[model samples]
Target: MYSRALRPCLITFQVHGRHFSSTKQNNRRVTVIGAAGGIGQPLSLLLKQSDAITNLNLYDIVKHTPGVACDISHMNFPAKVTGFTGPDQLKDALRDAEVVIIPAGVPRKPGMTRDDLFNTNASVVRDVALAAAEVCPKALVGIITNPVNSCVPIYCEVMKKAGKLDPNRIFGISTLDLVRASAFIGQAKGLNPKTVNCPVVGGHSGVTIVPLISQCQPAVSFPQPELEKLTKRIQEAGTEVVQAKAGAGSATLSMAFAGARFAFALIRALNGESNVIECAYVMSDVQGTKYFASPLLIGRNGIEKNLGLGKLSDYEQQLVKAAIPELKANVATGEKFVK
Candidate 1:
């Protein structure tokens, strides 16, 4: 799945029984803001393998950030790895970054909802957005910090205030929902999870997560009750991890994989690849909300086009309808935080 998802540096094409190798160098500077955190560490490791990235900057307030970077540097990837510790060096980490991914912030404990993470993560996102606006205003930003339904709005509001808001370039990394949906659907149907494609829309939270099981690629079907059960499982999969960890951590490895997958999609698009589509939470008018996550065609300048929600099954329709109010409230909470 990783190899297929991430484009390597070299490609061989065959023509008229002759093989040719094309070595296209994709040199994009990528920064992982919370490099020492649970998600950031694994995420940085995954990004290192992508030939699309030329520089991988890992930054954290933790003193061990440089150690993490040093550890990853030994892997012998083409991308050069650097670490910046403390707020004093954040500017250096973000400077000229083409893609900025923020997986920094606290993880949800066993009993805590994503909303419970708001106070701390919101502040962290706001500060990082402010720095990004000052240093790399045009960089593609992916917010992985939680209460994502709100944190994304907070990041946008900060950028907007800085007169650097480009709605298309800033994204809330909600690929985990899509990943979880695909995995659950695949397990139930006995298919390869990598080949299963499911589009999860709405916001990235409890009730706001709406999976379009009816529209899954390969056209999978489920009994109505089974469909509802699968959808609920996808929605609450993060909590499942948190509980299973017994408060150790929350969805770090899976979230890192999902975050890396989404980041690579953005990198591929930025490198002029066509039809690079992925779902991300971003400022939008879809579903009468300020921010929504749906399938998007990513291009060099960011969102090329938004493929809005397609034909919805009755159950899917109800899920979306039920999600609106909660999504609005989350957006309101985020927007209010910026003010």
Candidate 2:
């Protein structure tokens, strides 16, 4: 379940045009790669429930996607579901899609870092991203693939090579970190988690994930020791989930929820709504890093504006400084993999 503040209900807008038939005329066509995976299934389910989505396409290397699609189609939601399996069907799945989300990759194990999952996942993301480029070049692409710090650049590289790269439309989903920051801080202060909005920036791995708790909305303060402890815990939350699952899985459900939340924000933006904002990792110029996560204003094009990291406390500034090297190395590894 998501906090009310975190999950807004779907909004429908009236439409007028000789070319349009129903309210669904303007809704988006969304495609999900790796739709049978732990994260993809729930994310698809959430998107299926949204009134803003008119058609949902599911694709995966695994053959189970049809069964997942068949099951989800039984739901009464307005979004029609279709499943595509294997590389042969990839183009069909991506065709006409306005929004494409990739969460396909191997899950992380207890002792492994995100960088460790890069070998298998990088190719997975690259192939899928390339397919999107060939078939749905204008789609707003949201990548939830592991080792996002690297995979995002890998995707960008592929898109660039194809000459279909729309810098504004490519995004790395880092909302899970923001979700964790708000939840943890709210718990610590006995405030409503739903009311807590924490802006998380930097990159999407280990120490690179920076939670700007100092800029939390409805401002609150923490002792220096507690602040340091909370920051570390937020940074390592993914590992904590991996260890807690005893190697059976990574953070699937919560991640699905977070991915859905970001995707919906995109859908709203595409619907011509204004003032929608969320935190995302994208090709950025913040702090001279090649790609950074910052508060982004989402609109019909994708990232309407990059709200650079607002003022950071000395400690938070140090966190950003420490993240740049690792972030750069990860990004280079991805770019190299593409070449």
Candidate 3:
């Protein structure tokens, strides 16, 4: 279990060394916007088990939100779980939520890009985001829909129009990329994957997802040929899972873990603990863009500090330079969708 009680400071949040107030203690509600799909199902399961969560709200456009809630309710977890289905009840589902995660959208098919999945998922995300603004404007919103490079902007546009947009309270969930990067790189290096904590920055998509290998903790080494092979593998890790599922699903289980880690950190921040830091995609002015993803100092209210891209190796620097075009395009795509 990740701890939500880590020392709360403006320190960069780490998944290690954390604790949560789980004993019928904290009375905060966590609502998952899309709690029925491949990612949402397992992601909801994880959240239901969170000590920081006293109540859990499951919302979905699919007709099965109630069933999903029924299914997850069997778990002997302490948190109260409720399901809200269809459009009419969306606002009610978000009521009084402290944390609202949007994992409610389409998953990628075998040959689909995140952008391809966005065409349908974008509308889905917007509708939920609109409800979030109306019912739980103060909630920390964690977005997990596809083409997050774009959907996050869609959420921002919704909240902005509703006049409830808070950059610090909003985040794009790119932790999966970081998880996959660490796992793939650790496997390539024959090291334990748990020991690898590679912070992936930039947007979430094909080339837009850039992993900063130079800054991997505990210091891992790969030769030139190995570096290229490993980087490609890390970059393409999602594809490996998608192909492995063979049309059954995308990377849901691992994404759930990453999402939980993020949630735990937020809970820790709320608990007034120190030294809780994690890399997440957030609205950033660290560079030229209105938003960028990097390591952030998450505090009680929202983002405490926007840690700019740290010093990268020559190879990593090259990746950052190469990724700008893709990142900018992805950001543009999301912005246009909202417009």
Candidate 4:
């Protein structure tokens, strides 16, 4: 169904067998905290196709939870599907999972910024994230909740209070920005997005999203004005999707693709894959902030190495400078939520 309607741009990178990969396809349970909405539904569907997952549980307050569960269960993938419709059953949905991807909370709509979503989704994601903290304390959490710059700090603080927060294991899924930047750049320059890598840092919200196009590998130089246009385009890609959708929702299908891509990277790292790197907003001291995004090397234990900000072009440096205040403000928002 997804293939017929939603084009899958990501090509899976897998090294067959459990000895080299983290995918057990037997006992490892993975859970989705909010699996009913636009992002969640597509993300869950992507997870349904993962071989590393043996059990897939979904938690959502929506009434259609069981129907979504039933629908996903029909997939030929080996994972078993279960749905928890409310907070009462949230524990059941989260129990003993090795990985949890939270795409819960409201998406950005017309006239609202991702930060504007903080008022509504902050508590929703925090509450659901706390359940994962309690039920699967050690699970690697890939947070897809918006205001991610802030919500991640919220997740960190709440998990800390619950005595389950692992700095390395909790990641704010910022792969979408990188995905979007690469796609946009690729389209304009006619390069394959899969091979064009751009390092996007700072935060996941507007103005806070900093794409280091200067540091792109297999590099190409953009004329100064063209560079500014490309950077602005990458930064505003979320709003581009929103305005194009005309109040329907934010980037769902593309985000779903990015979510799947990040999830697969996590699975590979856990399996001891070497040279695995993905960008995510997470706790870091690389830029004087408690959390920042840069390239991170993943291994059997989540983040094995934090690759600090590499050399940037003068224009890129200014972009980062401009983004810091916005990113810092966003981080402070989530931190306050937890505090």
**Lowest lDDT 10-residue stretch of candidate 2:** 13-22
Write candidate 3's Cα lDDT for 222-316 as tens digits. 78788877777777778888999999878888887777767767776776655566767777776555667887777788788777677778988
Candidate 2's TM-score reads: 0.93
Model 4 / residue 296 / CA error / Å: 0.5
Regions of candidate 1 where Cα sits further than 4 Å from its true position: 1-23
TM-score of each: 0.93, 0.93, 0.91, 0.92
Model 3 stretches with alpha carbons more than 4 Å out: 1-25
All candidates: CA RMSD (Å): 5.1, 5.1, 4.2, 5.5
lDDT for each candidate structure:
0.86, 0.85, 0.77, 0.80
- Misplaced by over 4 Å in model 2 are 1-26
**How high a TM-score does candidate 3 get?**
0.91
Clashes of 1: 0
Candidate 4 clash pair list:
21-271, 22-271
lDDT of 1 at 103: 95
Pairs that collide in candidate 1 are: none
Candidate 4, 140-241: lDDT as tens digits: 889998888888999899988988888999999999998888788888788987767777888887777888877675477888889888888888888998
Name the better of 1 and 4 by lDDT. Answer: 1
Cα displacement (Å) at residue 128, model 1: 0.6
Cα RMSD (Å) between model 3 and the true structure? 4.2
